[model samples]
Target: MEAGEPTSLQIEKQSLHDQVASRIRDLIIEGHLEPGSRIDEAKLVEQLGVSRTPFREALRTLAAEGLIVIRPARGSMVRKLSRADVFSMLEVLAEMERLAGRTACERASDSEIAHARDLHERMLEYYRSGERMPYYKLNQEFHTFIASLSRNETLCEIQGNIMARLKRIRFIGNSEPEHWRAAVDDHEEMMDALAARDGQRLGDIMAHHLSETWQRVKNVI
Candidate 1:
């Protein structure tokens, strides 16, 4: 075996868990599962066509990720974000996005920068067209692209975790037209900083951008 290669059993186990996790994650993120709803393990296992073992493992994995809370007698429920949780998470997201923007400005290639600009423009069009769902999806992709362009895997992972945790709150904000427009404008500023390749300015802009979102959504969450 190669020094870095995983054993066959290990690879299989990871694949099983990831498959199970992805199915469950989709349900939660798409709002089908609903926050604070009880997870019916029997129903989920039937729907996913997986057995108890893998289903339970997937639940444990999600619990570890802070997406769900498993209580002993009460069973598993989707994690509810308190107002405080929203504020604290936004604070962390602001810092993470700032780091991502700074690194992207420093390390992203010209092609990467151009791609980010294209995504931003496309999202703006979607926003203007009043296609809320598509715009929201594209908006998420744009931020993720910028994070990936930073070329720091750890930073990207951290931002991904933050995004996952905040997805429900973000959806709440997006449902409001005024907040949606404000978010689009912030993305424009972020794109401008990336175009200039000014790491310092990009960092500051990203932090402020996330901070504004926190301000807008904290009271509602």
Candidate 2:
């Protein structure tokens, strides 16, 4: 092994911390630990069966991702967004998604598009069966995959960053049956335009879908 190289134990520990972060992230995104609510660090740590070290590390990671806010003396709390804040973020996200969809149509190969289609189909099944969490997870994955098809590193990075912050809001947006069905319909149109390689239409749908997302979730947030 080279000098300064991390041992297997080190690697395992890092992965453990990452896993803890994911667990906590899910807790926040699923509203188990709701927005603007202070985290009960001791209780959560014990409940998760993790040491304070890794738990605190996970919290710091979330803080960096804009999902949680950590104060100097006070404990951490889930980040809260105002209606206007959501609107502004969605506006930017819409533009990014618009560009990503258009570019993906022009750039993505057949196999790449097929893979995204597969994910969408899986998400659709979850929706059909009324499994909200899995459906929401796959929905986010599909959108993120579309952005990757553009093959623009910076665009994907920015989109993922913004998407992370809005995961909770977006997931709960589909709490109503009507809104959930509407979102599924948007994905259907998006996939159709993508398959046709109609960049213009795909871009338009992407932009409009995000705008509608704001409408669906604004009341809740």
Candidate 3:
């Protein structure tokens, strides 16, 4: 009964679809629904205890995020990232990250740098503990924070989308002890560059780091 406030029914419906989409996303991330395998819509609908409408909406959301594909006759399926696909996405990601590094070096505030430093420390703790999942999550946050420090909305949006597409593969890249340690070292270098306000150096380092990361992912996948 208030302006700009969603009705209870509207709130409930939003909750339903968000829950459904989150579940499907987790399933895909956990590899329960293998890449390139078609999603069984009817089966998922039954299992999720939802009707066709919300289930379809959830699939469409994932499709938009590049997690799934919805073909005309074939239906929705988890997206399979080929070597080329991964490379292309990584190429864009590298450039975006490079730009973020350069811009953040010039524009990032002391507070922002401190925030990143805190995240870096936490990530190191996760790495030392051998908690891959938590470390990966922190890894994502660290990159995202750098992007935000860029102060460029377009770059951040583009970088975020590409990162989302590469999430599952990037996690796999961390499966190797050597690769993971190298990535952490790269982060340390990036932090140094940011603190010193060396835009060009940070940009170069960011590009090379992402390229090396792609090599690791390529070898594994």
Total clashing pairs for each candidate: 0, 0, 0
RMSD of each: 9.1, 8.0, 8.0
The number of residue pairs in model 1 that clash at the backbone is: 0
Question: What residue runs in model 3 are displaced by over 4 Å at the alpha carbon?
Answer: 1-16, 42-53
Clashing pairs in 3: none
Which segments of model 2 are wrong by more than 4 Å? Answer: 1-15
Which portions of model 1 miss their true places by more than 4 Å?
A: 1-27, 30-32, 43-61
- lDDT tens string, model 3, 58-114? 888888889999999978889999999999999989999889999998898899999
lDDT, candidate 1, at 172: 66
lDDT agreement with native, every candidate:
0.80, 0.88, 0.84
Model 3, residue 59: distance off in Å is 1.9
Compared with the true structure, what per-residue lDDT tens digits does model 1 show for residues 19-66? 888668756765777789899888777666678888889899888777
The residue pairs that clash in candidate 1, if any, are: none
lDDT of 1 at 30: 54
In order of appearance, the predictions have TM-scores of: 0.76, 0.91, 0.83
Sliding window of 10 residues with minimal summed lDDT for model 1: 2-11
Using lDDT as the measure, the top candidate is 2
